[model samples]
Target: DLQQQALDSLVQHLADHHNAEALGVLCDVADAAAVERAMALTVERFGGIDVLVNNAGITHRSSFADTELAVFQRIMAVNYFGALHCTKAALPSLIARSGQIIVLSSLSGFAPLLYRSAYNSSKHALHGLFETLRYELKGSGVNVMLVCPGFTATDLRKNALVGDGSVAAQPPLAMGKVASPQDVAEAIYHGALKRRRLLVLSNVDWRARVLARFFPRLFERVLLPRLSGLKPQRAGRF
Candidate 1:
């Protein structure tokens, strides 16, 4: 976590409530060296990793034409390369333990959303990368699970960056009924327990995927207006 206090609170909560021995390592996933050190510490503390969850990500809200190139690079660095780094660092331990890799992706990974080109591309890249890894790792006893959750109530929107790399002035519109983080977590837990390859968390996202896949024009006609309405009111050019 970026904030050590949040990490410590979570660690303490896990210990107090779940009786789970947890270690909090303050490291930025975007930094390869930091991720390596974090992985080393985890392996040192726990002997080996059974599950590696690539959940670190950031989102941006801006039209592709107006977004600064640096914005896209920053998003990709954290959302895609961050996951890549952690996976690489933990692969040996995971392989040794026949462990699982859980990636917290989004419905946007497969389905398109307005003003999030960078975020969408990063998640798409994740699906491509990990799916291939899964195929290559077949019979290797390492499971890679990709989870696609719909609009969940989380700080992601509050922390979303704009084209100028500042915190967004407005929250991005939700396409469907907002999901609770608890519900999403429950689904992820069950999905991981079953070693499922793909876990789509919400019916809204499932329907959107189907619509986007089978009826692209209709999907656009229906979704575009809603998304367009949510576009930030500020000037597009940064």
Candidate 2:
């Protein structure tokens, strides 16, 4: 809630002062049909999509045992399938233009957090998909970058799904620990500009990721406690 208001205010200020003709906001869901329509509209308007930012996502805060099937699927639908749909729709234009694809993932993608099964799985799957796609699309002049942001304030928490495929009782606020929306946007721009394979936005996220790899048991022992405490109350109930 704090971050949303700030972000909205910033957008308004920029939109007013900059008179940014290149910037246009649209309401397009990440579903297959919506992406298809968006792509068609974009191509019709701008001639083609030079860059694709696959950032649409939702979150969940519950253990796998407590998470419902529908909740899990909904998370996948928005976080993973949404990206897929948009990427598929935009690929033809990107391929033609030799453009770039930027994916906004999360730290949870690299290292799992307790009580975040749906959210973690969606991001992990996204990482796998994009990493493989990058290799497969080599020499095609298409660049893919995955941007992993660590806990910048976002409304997804307020709207995050719970076990019953409904909004969580509380926002995902407590789970996130660092950064800001502007910080994340800057990271996104920098990574896209440099065409980096993976751009980690958080100050210590990369280090944490590496540490987790080198010391799994130790990482879990430390992280699980912190994560468990952040779990949403009454979240797992179907």
Candidate 3:
């Protein structure tokens, strides 16, 4: 749980819905010590961590020039360093068990979007770090999966930061199908079970990945106007 209320909500949700025992621990993944404590609690509750899911993330939705430096820093702290700290804390158990590591990346991990410089950067960092880790753990039996979900219907949208670091009051422009959070979760679950290296959910996400890979210049030209909620200027007759 990243926040106190998040822990309470998880506990209550588990109590109300699931019969299996669930453990909750408060952690600020940005803090190495906090992650250690949370992982320790997890180990104390269970025998060992078989799977490490680095899913906690935050987003900033302001243009690079307008967005505050602090906003970018905060996003990196939660989205990149957060996962780094958690993975570091859980590595020993994961190595011993040949456990799986599931990283919650985004379509932006490969596809760039305007007004999301910080968000995209964090995810790109995850890909670089985990892809290297995957090679290192190839024969060690620990499989890594990076799940890239397209725009999902979730609270992260409500928490997106604007230029001044304030939450954006309006909802984001709909550039693609907004997948249900449940759908994304189920896809991630199955992908982890199958030991997939990179799972891009939804057709929209796949298109984004493909465009970025094979038609990057075209993708960038189209994405800028779309994300900015504007139409690109047409070439005027000279």
TM-score: which candidate is best? Answer: 1
lDDT of 1 at 81: 97
Q: Give the alpha carbon lDDT tens digit for every residue of 1-238 in model 3.
A: 6577877888889888986577878778889998999899888899899999998998867779999889989899999999999999999999989999999998878878788999999999999999999999888889999998877888887788898888889867666678898898898889988999999886767866876798766556665466556785443332
Q: After superposition, how far is residue 13 of candidate 2 from its true place, in Å?
A: 6.6
In the range 44-106, model 1's lDDT, one tens digit per residue, is: 999999999999989988899988999999999999999999999999999999999999998
Which ranges in model 3 have alpha carbons more than 4 Å from their true place? 232-238
Alpha-carbon RMSD, each predicted model: 4.9, 6.1, 2.7
Better of 2 and 3 by TM-score: 3
TM-score-superior candidate, 1 or 2: 1
Give the 10-residue window scoring lowest on summed lDDT in candidate 2: 229-238
In candidate 3, list every pair of residues with a backbone clash.
none
lDDT of each: 0.88, 0.78, 0.85
Candidate 2 structure lDDT: 0.78
- Cα distance off (Å), candidate 1, residue 62: 1.0
